[model samples]
Target chain A: MTSEFELIRNHFVRPTPQAILGPGDDCALIAPALGMQLAITTDMLIAGTHFLPDTDPCQLGWKTLAVNLSDLAAMGARPRWALLAGSLPEVSEPWIAAFTDGLFACASYYGVDIIGGDTTRGPLAFCLTAIGEVPIGMALRRDQALLDDDLWVSGQPGLAALGLAHLQGRTVLAEPLLKPCLAALQRPLARVELGLELRRRGLAHAAIDVSDGLLADLGHILQGSAVAAELFVAQLPPLPTTADPVLARQCQLAGGDDYELVFSAAPEKRAEITALADHLALPLWRCGLVVGAAPGQLTLLDDQGRVVPINEKGYDHFG
Target chain B: MTSEFELIRNHFVRPTPQAILGPGDDCALIAPALGMQLAITTDMLIAGTHFLPDTDPCQLGWKTLAVNLSDLAAMGARPRWALLAGSLPEVSEPWIAAFTDGLFACASYYGVDIIGGDTTRGPLAFCLTAIGEVPIGMALRRDQALLDDDLWVSGQPGLAALGLAHLQGRTVLAEPLLKPCLAALQRPLARVELGLELRRRGLAHAAIDVSDGLLADLGHILQGSAVAAELFVAQLPPLPTTADPVLARQCQLAGGDDYELVFSAAPEKRAEITALADHLALPLWRCGLVVGAAPGQLTLLDDQGRVVPINEKGYDHFG
Candidate 1:
């Protein structure tokens, strides 16, 4: 049997040139760059709750780190370091190797160093804490949205949920949509560049990742900013012609698992943001606008400007 | 049914004056003090592995954070913030309230801020990431042991193991020893001040927390420093009179769960360390010396000036 130390050395240990001290020590030491603040976030993924027990180790690893990186991206922080603490029912060298491969692949892409973590025996679960750096007092905050700001979302927000629905046999996706949907579900990319550019160029006033569907996550920004929103259903990214419009609407409105960014910016910056979309070759959909109304209140509008009642409010881990 | 947000607002939310942004945001933002290096560590506690399933919620919460704090203590860092990512079998309000109570108590005592984390529904488990600050280049590293340094350990090393033995019916403890042993096992305090003073004053050449047994943890320092050790068994803290001497010896030699600090210091600093012990009113046991030998080699010496045969090295989580 491989000892814990052997397991760490073989699988988890990697060259962390960015760290003052990496794994094997009681703690990993790092120095945040001068005049920078650290943005820290943690996410716990439990087998069966976050993914199927037999989910592919590689994709699981990618998604796990991606979700936390998305959090940093939402804050306009450059990804820096991560610590992954996990529990496994038993040790399987091949599983661990594949998992580390995927995890390191993501870390490498984001220029993040896996500094330190702990692993123990138990039900399969992983908790990752990611740390990123942003210039002092310059992180895009959720509470800074100005009234009448143009609210935008990146990428298609409902595809991952559609992929999940297909997986659960609730929706049948067309062949062309299957791969992209599943990719969105299993390997969503963190919007690090988009977020950094938005912050550095002063394009966004407030931002949040669209993890819990567009409406629900947008609700966070509205609530935090003590404002309201007017979302035009017609302006949301179009549902695929082959897909069920109602289900896609539901997914677009309240789907979970989308790692897209939903941000609010001054209306005048819309042209600049559109140019940014072309520059990054990514879609930037303007689907809503911040409004002055009761805090936490949201109104969905149809193309004709009629109120559309909403029932689904996004994913709740407990609900 | 209570939503995850309600649970977070009701139980996990706490004032974080130190954080630029706290819970409810995608990430917590903190600025490490200028001219300071950040020491970060992560620990995962799994049910039935790290603690019994029926363990008291309050104590489990305290021990979970304490163990990670112990790691910070080992690095001679001043713990400043923590992120707790946990999975729960279900949402039980009372249990969460009690757990947070204990968690906050420890954080308050140590001057740490509970910044942010994630919680989800799943099997019961927790992962905590602790971040601390140390003066640049002044952290007590495990690789800095100099030849001929006197090795020291703080407080009792074997009581926690004996406490486990008592709980497991492997041994019976006398009335007087029961409370302290159990306390050592369940509520072991992190020696933050001792570690801080040792590093700030440059009194210790190397340090590591005695979590995976004194010998095993000490071996980390030995291996990292490319040095060896000669531990005087007779000079170790005395075994309890009422306990079986042989069993006590085994526990003292290779006990796990002891959150004590074992350090190595130059022979010249012995007087200052002794004075520190007196000042802190904590027993600092001098038990060994660093030796010039093949790296990672360790020798156990009996009072009769003979080498003692050894079998148990320390606890292996995977073994």
Candidate 2:
């Protein structure tokens, strides 16, 4: 019988150049760069709850690391190492091989080392802890947003949600949009470069990754910074033209899993932000502005400056 | 409905003085001490696999962190920070409260700070990533043992298995031993102090924590170090005196879930090892010797110097 240890050694053990010690020992050893603080985050993905049981093992692996990397991006940290803890119902060599392939693909892309982790027999689930590094006291924080700061987002938001909707049969999309949306859902890129640039240039005052939709995740910043936000619905980036306007709006406002960074910056830094966007060749959308009104409150306005009613804020696992 | 976020904030969020940034952020921040390398490890515990579904939540929580801490102990590292990712089938305030309390209790004992993690709704499971620190190039490794090294084990090695056996109704234990045995199973200490001392004093050449039974875990060291071992079964530490001799032998040889440290040192260091053990007021059992025989080979010998027949090596999740 193949034991968990052999499975790990066969599939997950790889040469980790970044680590002083790697998978063979009890713990992997890493030496963070001088004058840098380690940034750490963990995320868990369950089979039925986080992904479809029939989902491709490769995509599942990619998404698991991608989501955790997104957290590092939000913190303006440089990805360094990760630990993956997974529970599998049974041993399937093919499944594990494909999963590790996809996982290492993303890790290689982001230049993050898979240092160490654990594997066991149980339900299908994955929990990844990503470690990164940032200059001391330079890591972005949710509670540092200043009132009157312009709220910005990287890349088009809500594409992953649309993909999920299509997969769930709640919506149907055609051609080019279908593939991109599905890719967004399956292999969303963490905005690591954008975050690093923002921090290195001292631009963003506060930031958060949009995992639980635009409004809900931004609300985290609002509550943390004790500020309110006013988002102009008309100014929001356009969704796929093929989607219905109402469904598009709902997806943009309340759907999760976008893995885009939403940040707040001083209005005076608009020129710098534009230059940074130009350098990265990624559109930086100015969607809203931080306000001093009721803390944690969010207001959405139409083109006519009238309030738009929102029934749901975002996805709630228990709700 | 109680959302995953609220559950985390209410139960898992706390003041983390050790971390530069704690929970409620995208990622927690920590600074390793100068000239130290960060040692990291992760472990996953799943319901019906790592623990019984009816197990106490508090004890489960303690064991979750304790097991991960044992990994750090084996590497002779000082525990620093941890990230916990968990999935729960349903929300239970009391259960979460008790679990976090027990987790924190163990963390406080080891001086580990809960930095950050994720919570989701799904089947009950937990994956914890623990970080520790050791001076550069000073970590104890399984591959460092040399031929003729004295193999030593800390504490009673089979008490946990005995406790589990009693709980499983495989054995009947008297009152005096029952509570302590159960405690050994449920709340086994990680032997962190001993590991630290061994590394600090430069006494041990190789070390590993006994999580998967002495023979199996020791086999890892032998294989990694490219050496063989001869274990004197009669010299093995005794379990509770009340345990049946045959059953105790089985537990000592093949049963798992003991968090004691097993290490190897040069034969000439025997006096220093004894002195250290005397200082700590803990028995250090010298039960085996590393040899230049076939790599990864292990032989068990009785008092009469005859080979002892072995059936099972250790617990194998898939086996």
Candidate 3:
């Protein structure tokens, strides 16, 4: 059996080219880029809570780190380094090997270095702390939204939720949709490039990642910026014809686990944003507009501009 | 009933004066001090493995962060911020309240900001990621021990192990030793100040914190620096006369959970180090000397210069 130290050395230790000192040290040493500020986020995943206990180790590893990178991406920061700490029930070298392969695969794709972390014996769980760099004073923030800014959401937001529903047998997704939906849920593609471009080109006034439902996450932005929003139900991306439209709309409005970026930009930048969408070959949906009504109030409007009633909010772990 | 967001905002959210942006955002923003490198470390504490599931919530909170800070102390870094991600079996308001109090107490005492984190539902566990700063090229390292340097240890090394032994009913502690031993086990003080002083004054060649037993942890330094050590058993801190000398000696030699720092310093710095002990008002014992021998070797010598044979190594989570 591999000892704890041997397990770490054999699996978790990797070349951290960007770190001044890496995994072997008591603490990894990283020099912040000149004139740049560090953005830090931490997320925890627990077995049975975050995923099924028997979920594939590889996908679990990818999703664990991907969720954290999504937060950094929302801040328009370049993902740089991460520290992973977790508790394992037992030592299974094959499971660990597969998990690390997926973890390193995500880290490699995102240009992040796995620097340092800790492992312990207990129920299965993982916590990841991701660090990224953004030019001083340029990172996007939820409180920076301006009244009348065009609210944009990158890519489809409900696919992950639908994928989860399919897995739970709540919905049977069409054969073609099943693959993409599961991919969205299991292997999220964080919008790092879009965030960077938006910040660099001065396109976004504020931003947030859509982890919770679109409405609930947008409520976070509205509450932070002290504004309201008028969302057009007609403008939301259409559900696939084969999927139940009501359930799909419910998932789009209030389902969680979508790692898409929801941002607000000046109305004048719509053309620039459209060009960016074409440039990145990703959809940028103009779904709403920031308004100046009661803070954190979301008004769903139809094509005829009539108010629509909706009840679903979002996921709260302790709710 | 308080939701997860409310629980966080009400308890975990503390003022982060040093942070550009504190909690409530997607990511917390911190500007690294100029000319300083960031030292980052992550540690996970599982209820059953690291502590009793029914242990005091307040102390558990303190130990979670303290262990991570101990890593920063080992690096001779000034702790700046921490991100705490954890899973709870259930939301017990009073338990969380007391836990946050202890957590914030340590963070406040250490001048660290609780920036951002995540909370999920699962078996109770915590992961703390601590970020500290050290002057460029000035952090203490394990691989810098010099031959003939004095090996010094801070504080009593085996009290925690004795405390564990007492708690497990393996040993009956005398009245006077009980409280102190329990405190040593439950509330360890990281030698942050001593580490800073050592690095700032260039007093130490290499350093590591004693989490594992003295011999086991010292072995890490030896292996890293490619040097050996000769420890005088008689010079080891004497066990109390009231306690079983054999068990006490065993605990002292091969016990774990001691957060005290063990360092190697040049022989010429003895006087300065003694002065430092006076300044800090802490015990600094000169226990041994780094030697030229087979790397990672530890030789124990008695008062009569005879070698002593010992079988106790250190605690390994998976061993």
Candidate 4:
């Protein structure tokens, strides 16, 4: 049997150029950029609950780090370092190799380094802690949104949910949309660059990543900022040309796993944000406006300006 | 049904004065003390592997943080912040309350703060990431042991293992030693102050914490420093006055879970270390010396100055 140490050395240990001291030491030593604060977040993914049993190890690896990176993006921080702790039922060299390859692929893409971690024998699970950096007091926060600020979302919000529905055999994607939807579901890209730019340009007043569906996560921003929101459903980003309008609307409104940035900004910055969208070649959909302080209330309007009553808000893990 | 967010808000959320931003955000923001390097380490504890199913949630919480703090202690770092990611079988509010209480108890004792974490539903497991700080270039390391340096260990090295033995019904401890031994096993304190002092005073050439048995952990230093070590069995710290010499010797030599600091220093610094020990009111046991560069070879000697053969070196997770 290969020891845990050997397994880590074989698969996870890589040269960390940014770290003062990397693996094999008691701790990995890192120096935050001068005049910056470290942004830290942790996330855990478990087998069965978070992913299917037969999910590819490579995708699992990418999604694990990607989700944590999404959190950093939401905070408008630049990715820097990560620590991964994993539990596997047994040691499989090929699986580990592929998983680590996927993990490093995402890390390299975002310019982050895996500094230290631990591996053990148990049910399949992974917990990752990602560290990033941002200038002091410049982090995008949930409580900083001003009343009447325009609400915007990056990319399509419900594609990943549609993809998940397709995977679960509840809905069949059209041939043209199948590949893109599944890709969205399996390999969501975190909006790190856009987040950094938003902060640097002083555009976004508040921001959050769409992990628990738009309505559910938007509720977080509203409650934190002690405000309400009026969303123009007709102006929301279009779903992937689905035939079923009800299903499309459902996924668009309440689907999770989008990893898109939902942010608020002063209405006057519309032209600048539009220019940013053009430069990045990504859509910046203006979907709503922050109403006055009225914690936890969100109103949705139809194309004809009629109120739309929502029966289900979003995905709730324990509900 | 209690949602994951509700659970976190109810149990894990708290005011973190040391952090610029704590929970309720995408990421916690922290500032490292000026002119210091951040020391980071991650550790995972899984059910049926690191602990018994019936273990107390409170003790589990302490042990979880304690182990990670031990790693920081080994590097001579002062712990500052921690992130916890936990997967529980189900939501049990009482269990969570007790666990968080114990976790905060240890955190407050050490002057550390819980900045952020994640909670999910799955088989029981925990992964904690601890971040600390140390003056640049002052961290004690396993690879810097000088040849002919004295090998020293703090506290009783095998009491935790003895407590484990007692828990397993392999041995019965007398009334007087029962509580202390059990505490040693379940709530081992990280030698934070001692480690910081050791590095600040420049008294130790190399350092490691005894998580694995003495012989096994000592092997890490020997291999890392490319040096050999000779340990005198007679000079080893006395076990809790046990009658079973064989079990006592085995526990002292190869038993793990000590969480005590094992360090190397120059013979010329002996007087200073002794005085430091006196000031701290803790025993500093001198057990061996670093011979010359010869990777991975450790010799054990009896009181008669003759070599003693050993069958087991230390705990191997896969062994």
Candidate 5:
């Protein structure tokens, strides 16, 4: 078991910048630029529930921060500061250090400060509350998508699901998908740049991070916007290599922990968006279109013009 | 065990006026008032580590918030919004509901919105990341106190320590300490009014909220300012009722969790400080005077000019 002091001294405690107070006291403090509203979100990754028991400590740490960044990305807010509370199964000094390295790599990648938090002995559970900054009223919401808008998702999908399959021994991942797949699971990138670009262009109708699979995540936009969506099976960004394309698409729609952005925008802005995509050099694949508010329906169209039966409903915390 | 949904919907799901995108979404969308710098802070409370197993749910919830409010208080910032993450031992409906009620009372008292967070199945743990608004460069810091300033503390000390002692069956509370003692533990109030008063009058040099025993917490102020203090034992506010005055002062020196403000002010501002204290209707007791560059030293003096031996330290998570 890792002693709480060793973990604190090694991983979580760091000298903060002049403007901020680091963890030690009852609270960590920060001063945000004036008049800007804060964007805040929290996520909990339990050892057995969110990750496998054998998941590497470094990857686990990275995912914890990455998932929080995905939430900030969804709101078109740049990462700023994060508070972490970790409940450990036992004390492991090396594990804490490795985890801290991975977590800080992502934090430094996005320029977020590690502010305040706590560590305690318990089941291996980690929770992060990320705070970000955006100009007041500029945050994107799921309900803002308009009908008939074209939907875009950054980067490819199903790689994380394939990674999980490989981890679980459900399938043998070939060399091509192996690196991409594992990276997808181990180090899912948050779409911070894409979100900011869309917000800067003032073009996106609505946006959400694809944390719980594309279909389920998009279901949030549909439910909130009071609209349905038409997802084209063939239009998804290409995966590495598919042993079965249908299963792969299903994974894209149902697999979890892919932190790509699924968002909607006006059809008229299509060319502008494409130009912006070229500028950013990240994928902006248009995978679907918004539909009228018929309520409680999401339909998928195949190349053969048949509606396929979907089996996976994505992951649920309790269900 | 409490299901995740039930735990979240009951304890955390506060209906926020600024929650354009509420829970169940990828990120929360909020609108902060324009022209105010956001003051952010994070505080964590761990089960067993911070609270006893049989602690009342309502008190746990209230103090969880009061502690964070104390941070905002220390910064001389106005509390506006909060993010909460709770890890639960199991789903207890009544416990959850009572906890929510207690938490909301604090939020309502301070006019803060509950924005976002995560709930997980683990040992009881909570992290609250709070945001406030203050004029840039106007917030207080530990290094701002001048060496020759007057040292002050609000409210009586050692009550919460007595309350906890009673709860743990280590001591018996008697008379006035019983009511204030229990209240100190159950509904620790943040000195929000005192904070505002200090800023309004421009009388306070530096300030901190007391959680760790005064000796240890004041040590922080001394370390940061590189100054020292000679604390007069007789000047400490009466402990309500004490069988032995010497022991009571000893408790005052090491007592913790009296969520009051300890501040420094120029000696010339004493009368104005008294006026502000009367205006707020909270007692303001000048307990000592800051000593110049006796650097890194804190001493206690009795009426007979004897130095009291101080040994007990504040509560520590690892210890």
Candidate 6:
């Protein structure tokens, strides 16, 4: 029902760098640096699957780009150009403009360009392919974390999950405390600058962005790095006023859509990595340590230091 | 239903140059020579919009790359890497396998790589964003086409349109004549090497692929070049066969999905262009003349020296 074109303009369209040929052409042209290669990633968001029908188009655009940029951030690539393919039920100029406007606002703020995209009639859905750059062999991957490495995460956890709870009619929970988490879900900042900085400084051994909830997403890193990780429950960052422990815990463990970076650093390089948070003005939290357990193993400890069984899995497109 | 991952592996996962990253990663990385910038383009195909339901997935894959390649061709770039995003209704593994097979075949044939892509559950749809390499200020564009220039096109026209007619239940379209057109439409070949060769030889003044009908797409070049053009009906490439004049004329003049290059060249360079085409094994046809018709005009001359009006414009995303 919201204006689509306006939504697009308010979020997606913008004048990017001179090297980029932004949207409205058959494809976008981007200029990569010498000795560097182009890094590309794509993800799709279906209306009912990715967001609620009542979700704001502006936020949807932001979230769409956020998720894609998160992928680039995971690889320690600097954001550049993006292509969007949006499926629509009908032609509504305003809605598209708003959506694109949000998209571009985020894109421009992140120094990214909306190169070329497709607009078609179908179920309301959108896909974005983000292209970026990194020096050859410099991209950080999830397979590099080593045992005894300290695992760190950027920003707080469970905010996005709390936001979902609020959307699902859980009024008994604190609203103001969950606002930041909701915003985290809605407008996650792709840590491109931070990611590249980490790689440049040789700070991160492995990196990934939390998308399918911390437990599930981090598992990819665990599996890739062929290591295990142990999380200290007491060390998890808590929202300012999320008084209900049960809600907060669920948000932390089971909620998805937190597009924040989780990376591992050598224990010796911990101080330098912590300085990254201050320099970049982003909150970096040390959440755990890589353990000698077999690959793909993950354990959560509570106050009594007993293991917590994880039964809930992250969102799966097919599941 | 087709297996989702298989669809990708068979259709999209192509054997790329060892210089580029494989498709198994978050992003595909490609390294180009220093000082050469990357040209990128993105296009989407909707089920009912770009292709028909019964349309062969293999041809769709080829045509998809062809159209996107045409964009890079127009820019005078060397095709390098492509990222794919497929949104499917059924996630059928077989269809995806066939589709990806076709996609990879085209990528490998064209010397491009399938770097990274995403698949999702939705209406059957696909989008591809491609990257190519071009030296600074060397890419051909519509604005450079000039007055009194010879307008040229590559390969035969009307075949794709004929093919489309066949697909649309035009049972009347018979003979060896109609088969080529169908093949042309279904398996449109991109003039990748031709474009690169032309750019290397500094041949074309302006260029664009005829995705929209010739009249409409050619108009873009004329308008951008700030000149008028006289399209000679006699100069059009011969129809596949001596079919019904009306159908052939309409198909050649207004039908789209032809991935051939149309460009303007100086009258003096005609022989050289032709020789180059011969060397590249691509058909080059001299179709019209670019001249000052009215400072800004596009004309189509019919038989018997009559000026014909082309009112039915080609495809428009929103128009």
Candidate 2 TM-score to native: 0.98
Sorted by DockQ (best first), the order is: 3, 1, 2, 4, 6, 5
Q: Write the per-residue lDDT of candidate 1 for residues A1-319, one digit (tens) a residue.
A: 3466576546988999999999889999999998899999999999998888998899988988999999999999999999998788888888998889889999999999999988888899999999999999999988889899999999989999999999999989988989889999998899999999999999999999988788888988988899999999889888877889999889988999999999999999999999999999999999998999798788999999999999998998888
Per-model TM-score on C-alpha atoms: 0.98, 0.98, 0.98, 0.97, 0.90, 0.91
Q: Report the C-alpha lDDT of model 5 over A275-312, residue by residue, as the tens digit.
A: 98898898789988898857535788877767877677
Candidate 3 Cα outliers beyond 4 Å, as residue runs: A1-4, B1-4
Off by over 4 Å in 6: A1-14, A20-27, A170-174, A239-247, B1-20, B293-296
Every candidate's lDDT: 0.90, 0.90, 0.89, 0.88, 0.77, 0.77
Candidate 2 lDDT tens digits, A1-319: 3465586546987879998888878999999999999999999999989999888998888889999999999999999999888898888888898899989999999999998888888999999999999999999999999989999988888888898999999999887888988999998899999999999999999999999899889999999999999999877887779987678778888889998899999999999999999999989999899988898898988889899886878988777
* Better by DockQ, candidate 4 or 1: 1
Output the better candidate (3/5) by TM-score. 3
Best by lDDT: 1
Across residues A25-110, which tens digit of lDDT does each residue of candidate 6 receive? Answer: 44456677776777788887887777887678788888888889888888899887788878777776666666766887788778
Instruction: Give interface RMSD for all predictions.
Output: 1.3, 1.6, 1.3, 1.5, 3.2, 3.1
Per-residue lDDT for B1-319 in model 1, tens only?
3466566545878899878888889999999888899999999988888888887889888888999999999999999999998888888888888889889988988998899988888998989999999999999999999999999999988999998899999999987988988898888899999999999889998999998898888988999899999999988998888887887888888999989999999899989999999988888999999989788788999999699987888898887
Local lDDT at A168 for model 1? 93
- Model 3: which docking level applies? high
Q: Estimate, for each residue in B136-253, the C-alpha lDDT of model 3 and write its tens digit.
A: 9999999999999999999888998899889989899988998888887887777899989999889999999988888888888998899999999878787877777888888888
Write one digit per residue (lDDT tens) for candidate 5, span B65-180: 88888888876878878877877767777898888888988989988888777776656777777777666566666667787899998887777777777777766767766787
Q: What is the per-residue lDDT of model 3 for residues A276-295, given as tens digits with 9 covering 90 to 100?
A: 99999999999999889788
Specify the poorest-scoring 10-residue window by lDDT in model 4 chain B: B1-10
User: In model 3, what lDDT does residue B189 have?
Assistant: 76
Per-candidate fnat, comma-separated = 0.90, 0.88, 0.91, 0.80, 0.47, 0.59
